[model samples]
Target: MTNIDVKDINTLTLSILEGADSYYRWIFQEIKPYLQGGILEVGCGMGHLTNWLLGEGKVLVADINKSYLQMVERRFKNHSNWMGGIVWDIQEDPPEDFPLSVHTIVCINVLEHIRDDLSILKRFYKLLPLRGRLICLVPALRWLYNPLDKGLGHFRRYSKKELCEKLTLTHFRILTLRYFNLFGAVGWFLQGTVLRKRLLSSVQVNWFNRLVSLFISIESRIPSCFGQSLIAVGEKS
Candidate 1:
C-alpha cells in the first residue's frame, strides 16, 4: 500500500488560519444537501472542514497521517456523532473493519495527490452503497500546473470534463460538476504560473481573506466555467 505525505504542515496551518470562514461555509452549503445518514471524509486535514461536517451528521474523519487522526480524535472526543478518526490510505485496499455502507464519502483536494486517481475512484465506488454520494473538490485547469503544484506533490490538476469522465468510468453518475473560486484562478496563475512561487505569503493570504466575502459575492454571479478549483458530486449507480 502506497501512502502519500504532503507534509508541509506549517504552510497548511497558515492557509487554514488565513482562509475566510465564509469560504468554508460556502463549500459546506454546497455539499450539505447530499450529506445524509452516515458519512466518511477522506483526508480530513487539520480538521478545518471536519469541524463543520461534525455538526451536520455522524462523520468518520479519516487520514493517512496518524498525527492528524490523533488531533481529530482529541478535538472531538466529547461529541457523540464524531465517529472517531481512522488511518486510511486511498491508494490501498481499505481495512477490513472499514465501513462500506456509508451514505456519503467526502474528499476535498485529495485526489490530485494520487497518481492513479481512477483506481481510487473505483475504490470509492466499492466503499459506497448503491445510490450513495461522493462529494469531491480538486484544483482545476491543467494550464495552472506549476512549481506550487509540484511542491505540493500533486500529480495533476483537473478539468470538469476530466473529473466527470473519471467518476462516470468508475460507475458514478454525475450529479454536480462545476468550477469554483473564479478569483482564485487569477491569483494562482500569477503566483504559481507567472511568478513560479512554491509557497503563498501569509500576509497576502490574510489580505485575501479580508476581501473573501467580496470575491465570493462577485464570483457567485459568474459562470462556473472559469475558476481555480472543480467541485463535483456523484452518485453510485
Candidate 2:
C-alpha cells in the first residue's frame, strides 16, 4: 500500500462519505454494464468506490492527486489480488507510466473540473482497446452554478445534448445517457441560486444529505423520474 501524507485522512473520508452512500449505489448500478477485466477510475477521491472495485480483477485507482491516490492505497492494502494505484495526468496526455491498455474507464464528476475535457476524452478513447467501455458522470444543469461549484474548481456544468455532442465528437457511441439525482436539483436551486450559500456547515449538510438520500431511496423504489445529474455509458467504436 502506498502512503498518503495528509494531516486529516479521517476527516476527509467522513466528509465525502456522509452524502455519498446513495450516490455510490446508483453509480455502481449504472456502471455495472461497462465494467470488466482491467478498470480505471479517474479522480477516485478518497477511495469512495476504490475498495469495491478492488474486489474485481485488475483494478487500478488512477488520479493526478498524489494524496488521494495514497489514501486509497493505504486504506485498501488488504485487497492485493488485483489492486494498484497509478498517478495519472488526464490533461495534455496520459503520463507514460499510466496503463496504456484498459477495458473500462469511469470518469465521475471530474470532467467539468478539467480545462480540456474533450481532449481528455479523446485520449481516453484512444487508450482503450477495441470495444472498450467508458462511464462518464458529470453535473447537469448549467443554471445551478454556485460558489461551491467554483470552489470545487468546476469549469461548467453540462446539458444532455451538449454532453452527448462532446462524447460523439470523441469517437464514442453513446450507449446510455440518463439523468440522476432529481431531488438534488431542487436542493441545488435553493442553496445555489436562492440563498447563494458559498459553503455548507456540517450539520446543515448532514441534514440535507439525509433528505437527499431519502428522496433518492423513494425514487429508486418508484419507476422513473428526471434528474439533475447526467450519467452516460459509451463504447469506443
Candidate 3:
C-alpha cells in the first residue's frame, strides 16, 4: 500500500488494480456472454474494464467523476467502438439525454459505494428494454470488511441472499448469480483481519495477479459456497 490520504484512496486503489490483469480477465469471461448491443458501463473508472470492451460494441462509459470520465474518453476516444462517455450520478435519475439505445448495463465494483443500491438498481431496470441485461460484480462478505473498505468508500459488502433479493425486488429475472475469487477471499481476510492492513501492497497485488489463472482453474471445477466477491447477471424481463 502506498502512503495516501482518504480522498485519493480510490485513485490509489485503481492504480493497484491496474496490475490485476488476470483477475479482471476472469471477470470479463464471466460477463462476456451477457454483453450485447449498446453497452453502458456505469463506472468506467480509469477504463480498465473499458479497455477489454473496446471493440465489443457501442461502449458508452459513465461516471459521476468528470475527471475520471474525461480520462477514460481520452484514453479510448480514437477507437471505432468508443461511443464516448457521460458524467452520471447513479443515485439520481439518469439524465434526459441518457441513451435509449443501451441494451446492456455493466456495473463493476460500483454498487457497494452507494448507500441506496436498490434505488439505482430500480433505475437500471427502468432504463433497459425488454430482455436487456444488468451485469454487476461486487465485493462480498460483510464480516470481511476492513479499513480498506472504508478507505475505498464502500458503504457495505453484499451477501448472496441480499443481492438476489434486491435484484428480484427490482424486477430483474436472475440469470447468473454466484460467488467468485475464492483465493482472494482468503487473502482479504488475512490482510484485513489477521494482518490489520488499511491499504493494499503493490507487490501483493502483482503476486496475486500471477496466480489468478490457477485460482480461476480451481474455482471453475469447484462450486464455491462463498467468495471474496459476487457476480450477478439479471435480465429486465
Candidate 4:
C-alpha cells in the first residue's frame, strides 16, 4: 500500500451505512450489470460498496485512508475474490501502477470530494483497457447542495449534463447515465435544506430504508428527470 497523509474519514458516507442496507443494496444492483472482469473500486471507504462487490469479480479496493483499507482487507480476508486493498490518492498517483487485470472501475460517492474531478477522470481513463467500464455515482442537483455536502468535504454536486460532459471530455463513451433515488432527494432536502441538519440520524435512515423497495418500484416506472444522485457508466473505447 502506498503511504500518504490519511485524512479524516467521510462522516457522511459512514453514517449512511448505519441502517441503509436496502438503499446500498439497490445501488449495488443498479451498477452490478456494468461490472466486468477485475474491478478496481476507488474511494472504497469502510467497504460499504465493497461488501456487495465481493463475489462479483476480482476486487481491488483503494482508498486514501490506510485504516479504512486495513479494515476492508480484514473484513474480506477469507473471500477469494478479494484482491486486497491499497492506499491510493487518485489525484496524485500515476495510473501505470494499477494492476493490469483491472477492467472495470467502480467509483461511488467519491468524485465530489475532488476539486479537479476532470483530472481524476482522465486518470481513471488511463487505468483501464479497451471496453473497460467506469461505473460512477455522485450526488446530483446543485440546488440540493447544503451544509451536509460541505461537512462531507464535497467541492460540488453534479448534474447529469456536468458528469456526462466530464466523462466525454476524458474520451469515454457514455454507456449509462441517469438520475437515481428520488425519495432520497426529498429526504435530503428536508434534513439538509429545510431542517438544516448536517447528518442523517440512524432513526431516519432506518425509517427510509424500510420503504426503499417501494421507492425503487415507483422510480422504475416514472421518468427519472431528477434525483438525489446521478449514476453514469462510461466505457473506454
Candidate 5:
C-alpha cells in the first residue's frame, strides 16, 4: 500500500479525510452535544481534527511536538475563533498558563501511545468541569498490534473491557465504547502478519482509509464483531 507521498501523516491525512464527511460527522455528531464552552484537543498532531471541525466552537489544538504544531499553525493561521495549537505534554502536569477548565477535551487515537493512560485520564478528570466530557479513540484489538503500531510509537491497542476498567477506575462514567473502521482490520491483519511493516503509499492509505470510513460511517447499524479501533465516550463525574 506504498504508492502516494503524504510527507507527514498528521498533515496529509487531513486532505484524504476531506472527502470523508460521513466519517468525521459520525464522530462530530457523537461529540456535538458536548461541544460547549471550549475544546482542548490533546495530541492534536497537525491539527487535522481542528481543521476538520473548524468554526465549530472555541478550540485549542495542543501537542507536545512543536514541529507538528508549526505545520498546524500554518494551516489555520487565518480563521477566526481559531484558538491555535500549543505545546502540551499530557503525561505531565498541566502548565498553569493553560486553561484546564475548558469543559471539553478530545484525545483521539492517542491513549494507546501513552504508557500510563490511566494517569493521563485522571489528569483530564481533574482538568474538566464537573460532568464534562472526554472524547477518546484508541486502536482496538491486540491482533492489530503490528510494526506500524510501533513505528508510529503506539504503546498498545486496547480492548473494550481493558479501556472501560481503566477509565472507570479513574472516576469517568463510561458513556459509549465501540469498535470502528471494520474494513481496516483487513489491512491491519495483513500488515501485522504478512508485511510486517509500517510504510504506506498514499494511494493504499487513502483507499483503505476510505473503505474504513465507509464502514465506520454506518458503524452504529453494525455489530461489534469486527473492526480495528475503539472510540469511547466518557464524562468526568
Candidate 6:
C-alpha cells in the first residue's frame, strides 16, 4: 500500500450509519444493476456499502485507511467471492498488482475529497475496460459548500452539469446523471450551511432514516433538479 494521508471522517459517517441502514439500502438498490462481474469499490468506509456489494460478484474493497481495510477484510474474510482489501489512495497511481481492469467501479461520496477530481475520473477511465461502468455519488450544489464540507476535507461540491463535464472530459459516456435525496437537501443546508455544524446530529439522522422511505417515494415521483447530492453512472468509451 502506498503512503497517503487519511482524513478522519469516520465520526462524520458513524452517526449516519447508526440509523441510516434504509438510506444505504436505497442507494444500493439504485446502483445494484450496474454491479456485475469484477467490482472495485473505492473508499469502502466502514464496509456499510461493502456488505451489500460482497454478494454481487468478485469484489475488491479498498480504502485509504488501513484500519478500515482491515475491518472489511475481517468482515468478509470467509466469503468465497471476496478479493480482500487494499489501502488505495485514488490520487496516486494504482500499484502494478492492482486490478484496474474491472467491469464496474463504485465510488460513492468520495470524489469531493480529492482536489483533482477530473484527474481521478481520468484514472478511473484508464482502470476500466471498454464499456465498463463507473457509478459515483458526490455532494451537490456549490452554494451548499459549507463549514461541514471544509471540516470533512471536501475540495468542492458538484453540480450535475459539472460532474457530467468531468466525465465527458475523461472520455466516459454518461449513462445516468441526476440529483438524489431531494428532501435531505433541507437538512444538509440547515446543518452544514445555516448552522455550520461539522457533524450531523444523531437525532436528525434517526428522524431522516425513519422517514427515508416516504422521501424516496416522493422524490421518485417528482422532477427534481437539485438535491443534497448527485449520482452519476458513466461508462468507459
Best by lDDT: 3
lDDT of 2: 0.74
Supply the TM-score for candidate 6.
Answer: 0.93
- Report residue 127 deviation for candidate 3 (angstroms): 0.6
TM-score (all chains, Cα) for each model: 0.91, 0.84, 0.95, 0.93, 0.84, 0.93
Off by over 4 Å in 1: 1-6, 9-19, 99-101
Clashes of each: 0, 0, 1, 0, 4, 0
What's the CA error at residue 79 for candidate 4, in Å? 0.2
Off by over 4 Å in 6: 1-6, 15-18, 99-101
Worst 10 residues of 5 by lDDT: 1-10
Q: Which ten residues in a row have the lowest lDDT in candidate 1?
A: 1-10
* Of 1 and 3, the candidate ranking higher by lDDT: 3
Better of 3 and 5 by lDDT: 3
Alpha carbon lDDT at 157, candidate 1? 95
Relative to the true structure, candidate 1 reaches a TM of 0.91
Q: Write the per-residue lDDT of candidate 2 for residues 8-50, one digit (tens) a residue.
A: 3334434656566655665676677668768888878777766
Q: How many residue pairs of model 5 clash at the backbone?
A: 4
Model 6: residue 219 alpha-carbon error in angstroms: 0.9
Off by over 4 Å in 2: 1-14, 97-101, 208-214, 220-225
User: lDDT tens digits, residues 1-237, model 1?
Assistant: 023234673347435553656667777877888787788999987777887888988888888888877877888888877887889888998877854347899998899989999999999999888889999999999989997787678899997779988998998999888888887888888887899877665666677767877887787787767788898999988
Assess the local accuracy of residue 20 in candidate 1 as a C-alpha lDDT between 0 and 100.
58
Give the Å error, residue 190, model 1. 1.4
